[model samples]
Target: MQLMHKGSALVTDQDIGENPSVIEHAKRMGLRLITFGPHCNAQVREMGFHNGNLQIGMGSLRLGISLQSDGHHMALNAQAALAALHALGYAPAQVQASLAHWQPMIGAGQPQLLPSGICLLDHSLSNHLLSMTAAFSQLQSVAPHVSRRLIVLAGIQPGQASIDAAQLALEPLVRDAQARRVLLYGEPLRPLAAALGDLLHVNWYDDLNQLICSLLRTTHKGDTVLLAGRATTNLALAADAIRDSFSGHGGHLIASIQAPCFDPHQKQMNMHS
Candidate 1:
């Protein structure tokens, strides 16, 4: 909060505006403030989710902006982004057009479509328990028509506090997502096997290769896999492995994992299969 000097503005959500600390800080810093949400009085407001997208509008006007993303939380993020652009003096039409093709960056809800017809939602970049739960909710909301739902979690924290939270939250989230299987890597998350043992089929892996091998063998057409955790390198390799596995038979599976290279000329990240 201290970093925000006078004349600098904070664009946030209505829910966050109610924080006493934030209110006090803004008052102290003489910070310009913009808040967005579904609240009737918010500067930017949202309508209900429809057809896998979010609709938002400025104040009480009809929702004129459509965001190509799922989840109510994501709608708030879109509103905040729009509010920031508004603060920067971008015209509403310009901002709307720019956001039309917006997609989440790699490891942040980016959906990778594989040749084998699997849609992998990568959320490994920010894989705290809260984010993991939100990922499941988003998947449930957006891709309910998918044939199979698989969840891969890597590098769960082994601390008792984390495990306890997982114990309370993991099973319900997985059930709500209607996931067919839960594949867990890293020894830290092995304890989750017991918690989810009866309601769902859980697999634990100590080796990344083994997990990749199993994933390749088991997942079929029209499946959606949600990948989330701390081992980002391992997660990227796994996603690439899945993509390359369907490219050819034997030799291609051994191909080196390709990093998501940014191609400035194309103005998008290029994924090599």
Candidate 2:
């Protein structure tokens, strides 16, 4: 693809697999090419969680990238961008400053904090297994001490394969987070209830209203609730209902939804004020 900057144009491969064609084309055009690979010279020195943000130490420059998840690809993308910037004479300090304001797109890696002290991680936009697993691992580290750890999984569609995959992805989070109660909704999640049988409190509901009712009744103060799964109309409705139920309860309700980064949809979480 062509990148235009200051009357100069640069071309690069779309992915690592297309490097051969990109290199050949560059050679034919007498143009210089800069490439990055899986095992590139630039590397991430260390990565950790600090104050709900990801701290990445790269080649003597430390940058804090904000997100609720691990962001496995994001680190690599940053490395490539830094390499390009370095070639263009940008200092490592300048690059670090630019990344200070880098925010994750909504439903991708954005994390929202409700007034009730609940943190919502929205990964509904892209739930690739690896990404989801990374996100949960980060969550496990930053999760605060609370009375109960609750997980709500919405419905998946297109058949049993998707359901099975989601279950496998979530099992580790359930185990690691020590989720005390899990609420499963929709037909696709029926099988999951049996799979997790007797491990913890598993409540299966065919109707969203029933699930919300159970959640409202069972949840107590200082509980951390995580809502994940496919975004459906019913799931949205249920999320709203649960958020409303926490209005005057003086507790947190974390809800994840699918939306673009700039989408302007906001609702009240607490009404006791």
Candidate 3:
């Protein structure tokens, strides 16, 4: 199954959470620095393309040339991006992670105007899909339709920024998705069940029992659903959900992709190490 989350490049084949070559690729991409919050930590604040913590938290920032985020700390490890920017011979741009604590940065008041290779801004991790939906909407207009969307989460508390981002991202898709195409995330919503009910129509399931019930009611094969974002890996439970309900009706689970970088060949191959 294809991975569906964003910023998979930051995570590596080893799963140790650090990719030595990440920065090298970032540099080749001509990455500068992009700040999200204000000048919080000097080291992190003015760093290069590598980064995160937008939501409490981040899914990372969607730059004018590349990027997309409202957050789930999608790409926090910045060393790779840093190396990349430097290698490109570009003085990384500056990003403002928290403007609420803003100060004179890169010798400029507005980050967008900072002529450095990097740019910074305190993104509103206040909404999940705000970045992704916007990016997807734009991509749909330019690229071929993949019928797949990604969900990237973070290691933050619900109160941090995940809630805001989730509401911003998932709700609209759920509301707009055509019937069987909607794929409710497999992980439990924790204390979020009430919020889940707000989205309209489409089959919504919290677990296998609900998934089967929804299918028994209406669904079909060739239809698509996305299991996006970060959560405790629950493949067994997800398998159970599908297995317990596989027998009912006209539909079949065609794809169960999790998260793949937007352009893995391009994104991952950037590793210089």
Best by TM-score: 1
User: What TM-score does candidate 3 reach?
Assistant: 0.29
Local distance difference test values of all predictions, in order: 0.67, 0.54, 0.31
On residues 120-214, what C-alpha lDDT tens digit does candidate 3 reach at each position?
A: 22111312344435433322332233332212122122345655444444545434432323334333333222344443332333444334344
Ranking of candidates on lDDT, top first: 1, 2, 3
lDDT of 2 by residue, 1-273 (tens): 344233332423235424677656555555555443244332433255445465655567676655333355665565556556755767756867566566666555455555555555545443345555655554555465534566676643434465566555555565666666777776666666666665646667665655666666666655656666665534555545445555544233433222221244422111112
lDDT of 1 by residue, 1-273 (tens): 688668887888888876788888899999877888887656777766665466676744554555665555666777788888877877666777666677666677766677667787877775466777778776775568634788877744434575546544566666666577777776555556556656536676666666676677677778888887775437766766666676455345553322212222322111111
Give per-residue lDDT, candidate 3, residue 22.
48
Candidate 1: regions farther than 4 A off: 1-3, 18-28, 59-63, 142-147, 155-168, 175-178, 247-251, 254-273
User: CA lDDT of 38 in candidate 3?
Assistant: 22
TM-scores of the candidates in the order shown: 0.77, 0.59, 0.29
Better of 2 and 3 by lDDT: 2
Candidate 1 weakest lDDT stretch, 10 residues: 264-273
